[model samples]
Target: MAGNKSFFETLVMEEGGNVTFGDGSKRNVVGKGTISVPELPSLSNALFVDGLKANLISISHLSDEGYSVLFSKDYCSILKPDGQTLLKGMRSSDNCYCLEASIVSNHVSMDEQIELWHERLGHMNFRDLRTLGKFNCVRGLPKLGKKANGICGPCQQGKQTKSMHKKGKYLTTKEPLELLHMDLMGPMQTESLGGKRYIFVCVDDFSRFTWTYFLREKSETFDKFKMLCNKIKNEMNSNIKSIKRIRSDHGREFENATFETFCNGLGISHEFSAPRTPQQNGVVERKNMVLQEMARVMLLNNNVPRNLWAKAINTACYIGNRVFLRPSTRNTSYELWKGKRPNVSYFHTFGSKCYILNDRDQLGKFDAKSDEGIFIGYALNSRAYRVFNLKTLSVMESSNVVFDDTRLKSNDHEEEVIFSDVSPLEEVVVSPNVGTSNVNNDDTQPIDRVPLLDSKEPAPWVRKLHDKEDIIGEVNESVKTRRQLANLISYTCYTSQIEPKNVEEALNDEFLVLAIQEELNQFERNEVWTLVPRPKTTNVIGTKWIFRNKSDEDGNIVRNKARLVAQRVLSN
Candidate 1:
């Protein structure tokens, strides 16, 4: 992080927070953006931390980004992934590595300035940034000098194995929302904390702008699609634009009657790729892979729980829209869709340790003012950060949050303490504790085993009856008549509390519907089964509803219970 605001050319003021230095003094981090220093690699996501006497560099962060930090008696060197020396630092008298270079000056040359913008745009190739500058396609881009050439360590690490997808023969859509590609990916091995197992992704062909929705079941795809339609309608009506066509693979979630009817109602043509061919819907197919890969990397790099996969994916989509450029237009999706350059100065590393103000409850003067949390994503409806609170074990959105992205996660206490914290959300199989850290508390004591008692004789209640007379006094017509009368009265009392036998009958009754919903909720809570497309060769099993009315000892109906049972006859 840079100390001075003048160090950043594109700083945003919205998401400022306090940063604590090693000396225990706190300074305000007012914004974040790219920082350029002559002869040094341009820094992306640099925080504008105010009131520091000297700029600090994190060797740990450079190592994580595929840079090698070498230290010796007199100096230290920062090398790129390919072992090329990028920067050298001298050991100070106080035994700290200080960089030889200084902060960027006001009279820096245009070439260095263009190089800085290159890093700002997610290390985009200079040719594209220059193209945008030349054509005036994107706002806030300055004129470019001759193509700035450099080896970007991050781009090399991220895209080394990736090859560009070949373009289609036909001309792409010319207007926003003219054509949309949508697809569904998942039923992930792990269900998210929100019980979401599927991601519905839609990408506009013209702008490459994408929208993602997390769904508990694939059956919800239609509902999310309808919601996106309403959102797009409101945003596009002023521009005289309407959805012209939408494309997806032949998944039942997309090819169903509900989706067809909705699209037809809006005068939108729905197109389907041929069965077994995913490339035809490659726009969203590729997007699904990219989003998942990015989210997976972020989660794994930060040692975050897999149950927050939905949050990571949501954040990935949010960042991709702002940072990624369309190859055809050399403009970011945000610029093309919203007609303005996106301000990403508020971006933070996903899963960074943060503190959220504990203002929800009254606190004493001596109490800590903030709760430790893990930064997850940005809230869509408000200007707040979404955080997973450690103490409450719940996810919340808060405007008053400070980030400590530079700190390393301590393996000593965090893993053991929070391992149980995630269990209530889902059954996660964590590795057994194997570290050598000594137990510090006297409360931990070894359990003493108790011996079992042996007995051969059976209890009186265990004996079986040999004859009917042993249990009851007698069996006669008078006793049978009494029993019949009791049963008849019970049946008459419950005549108004009938139970449904089938789904059709259950749907007609409000009480039965509520009972069914409760049962479904239980299934979801337990993560019984993920909803998925039916295989062609496998016979589909049918289900039946078994409903019952529970009565108290007074014969008053107490509760309506419903169970969804599979028909075994169909399985045969």
Candidate 2:
């Protein structure tokens, strides 16, 4: 947090009644609200007493916020139900637990001021503010404390429930989709992109990877279930095995004869929770809550319109599958569900300012060649990006995208695009990017073809690769080199951040300049070329400079290299 004063004004005094402190001294309560903290939600119901020297939270309040408070001989913490620490408090000299603050103001401790600003800022999530705070992402944001207590009162108020989820009632499943939790949400204030008013969700008990489907009517759920079942049957590990069991609320969508007959036909058992008891289907029930909250934050942060609710849900599901932890597998839901490590290197911040190549829709020679857009999600069925064109007010998918993922974001191409290989759509990954990020197509291949440097007639050199080639080629000693093959195959190294754009830029850097000079010296020493009178009709060849970087064992840049090479440019 920047520009936040160290001390605050004792500005607004209230006539609240007195309260007793842990030290047995009573003080007049001046003000109270949830305080912002890192990682956790706002600390709820924290009172601002007139004369307390330390920050304090009541143990009972933590319990109300669904956190477990633990005490040791000299340490303590407020933890989530899964035992992850939310806030760590140290035991003071008086044997009282006290949380340390990096920056405090007034006797009031800027928490109240933050609460005021927080509401003024449309009550954006403290976590979002904390992240966006790094680069002055928003205006009037005070420097924030490094840690926050996870107790947002408004957030809790929106989710007040009749009963808490029973943590130990269900055992974790061992196989993917061994049990499925189903739920529906909606009748939202805004309709989705496809005119949907409801969303149907499914959760895998073992992998915890959630799937979301939009529906215009509740009756459509039965049909969605059948579609999901058939999809699972085709994509599942074994074709013979089908869904074993399903758990859902006793809503008519899951209880009616149509749903029952479909499950019975597949030999799947359906488990329905008791009436009005939603915690029994807590898995998908909880997933819906998380998805809605995530969507709210994304739409709010990007200033996107409400009509794109379906896009937000798509992005939310994608993020949840990749980011959330699945306790049963001790890895991400994507890995367990896909059976391959998910590739996340291509991920860019959602809703960041960006531009798409206007190659197909350019107006004229002088018109702009890139259209302004905002990143929304990944493109389906391709290794491409999905974006909302700010000018066109429509969503389109393209791989030729550039992004400025910083507070200084603008339409100008000032900074380099976060990703380099936004080439035209080509086969790069095996699966569509649903909610899961894709691994590079080459990642699944055993080994990459070695880079080439020699010939230039068609291109340098590449091997025609087959699956078993690298597995035994090294030991077989019969693998062909550049001359062994009849027709040469061309392969280039993947696009990267390092490779110089032009020879002029390469020569400006000392390392590259020296590398090029060294190559020239080698050419002279070998007597490769000499100055001579120009010939009138000699159809000359062309030259190009290639640049690359070298690194040592730890993957740090160690050297810059430049290669001066000749190419046979045939004249027509």
Candidate 3:
């Protein structure tokens, strides 16, 4: 009995003496099963019989025998119908049976339990399930399986090693201008019409209102900044308690001695962002971007020249202050500063073709009526408009102008003409002797007049003596000695005509000689000479003199041009 009980314990089965068979018949089953038993049913066969007896099924080994047998409740009842029958069967010669009674129970299969476990919990991998199973508390619980979907490649590629971000604490101020952001933007490639290539941007921390100034050079920053500050102070009528702090990048223009001295003298604090870190001065940097973008779009759309970008940016800032709403307040900076709505009716299209009526002109019948100009931008510090004249290639200013936004650009059309015509007048000419005659007729002889000569001699001889005497006197004055007189007489005898000889002699005269020499020297100083040596066999052309007097606009003599001519000789 002890051995049989041990077998029942190992197999997890209940033991009974007799059991009722199927068909309501009973059978006496036997005493305890023997130990070291042979020819017993296999685990599969035992499970088959147990399953037939009860809806709840399990499999186990009854003994070491390979043969399988089936037993049901009818068999157990037939073996032991009553207590006396069971006792009789236990004493029987062939009573070697141990009966097991069928019991009703509910259970689940291993596969169904696994599916149910996965449904209750989420999907998990085999490795994860094995790890969870190692916990003795959760051992024997069903495991979950994972879906085959994998990791994202793009996400892994995009992930980079990054340092932890340090968030800076916000600095608070009590007043509008307490803290300000200042930056200088460029030495732009194109120069503005006013010759400005750089711009200064300043922003108020509290209201986020921005002010910008176009500058020809960075050196103008201090002067323009002082002007801005003075204007603000005057307009607001509020003494700046303190500048408090000024933030900027470490540009040399902003960090120079001049700027430092100015700030120190004013007792204003200055702060510099870390090297190469623009985000530290993000407010002004963002303002620069906004202004630049607005200017770029305006220029591109209007086909305005790139040089006008600075003016466009200034205008952009002006319009932005009036139209752009504050991020926190939902009100324009203009409204906040001026306490009124901005009037946009005064705005005009930039770079549009315009015609300006010349109101200043008191026009004659033949004068041009109007001037054509291209609108460049609005004038600063005034209500007038700025325009560019293609004819003059200069900018002009006017307030009364007619604009045609849809005007077509014409290749033949000229720019505005500045008319400068005056009416012609007649002049009165007087001979040199007329003044003397007039004074004589009034019976008042002037002290400078010479006595009149008498004409009593005959016409021919008298003219001859007068000409001869004049010639003799001129010769006497010109000749310094007898030798020069002899040379002059010899030259006059050799030439064919006395007129030509006399003219040549006059050109060779001292005053004419000096004037020609001076002109040649002047030309040499002006670098108008080119020297070239003549070839031995070639005929060199002779040079000659040409005279011209250069004059000023008022007809006054300024310079004389004595040109030397060279004529090439043609070989026969």
Question: What C-alpha RMSD separates each model from the true structure?
Answer: 23.3, 24.7, 45.4
Could you tell me which residue pairs clash in candidate 1? none
How far residue 271's Cα lies from its native spot in candidate 3, in Å, is: 1.8
Instruction: Report, for all candidates in order, the number of backbone clashes.
Output: 0, 14, 22
- What would the per-residue lDDT of candidate 2 be over residues 222-278, giving only the tens digit for each residue? 988888887787777465456799999888888999888888888889999989998
Please, what is the whole-model Cα lDDT of each candidate in the order they appear? 0.66, 0.59, 0.48
lDDT of 3 by residue, 249-318 (tens): 8887778898788889888788999999999898888788777766665554443435457666766676
Query: Each prediction's TM-score against the native?
Result: 0.50, 0.45, 0.40
User: What 10-residue stretch in candidate 3 is worst by lDDT?
Assistant: 436-445
Please report the candidate that would top lDDT against the real structure.
Answer: 1
Which candidate achieves the best TM-score against the true structure?
1
Q: Which candidate, 1 or 3, would have the higher lDDT against the true structure? A: 1
Candidate 3 differs from the real structure by a C-alpha RMSD in angstroms, to one decimal, of 45.4
Query: What tens-digit string does per-residue lDDT give for candidate 1 at 1-572?
Result: 87766555456765678888677989888778775544445566777787777777776767766888999999998897888887788999999888774323422465666655654443455666555665556445555544334544344544455467674444487778889999999888866645578989999998888998878889999999988888887876756678899999888999888888888888999999998998888889888877876666665545454556777677778767876777655678888888777655555666666777887989798777777766676765666767766555557877777765553332332221212111111211212111111111101111111111111222122222246656565555343344444454433322226677677877655445556766887897789888899899999999888889887675756567888888999988
lDDT of 2: 0.59
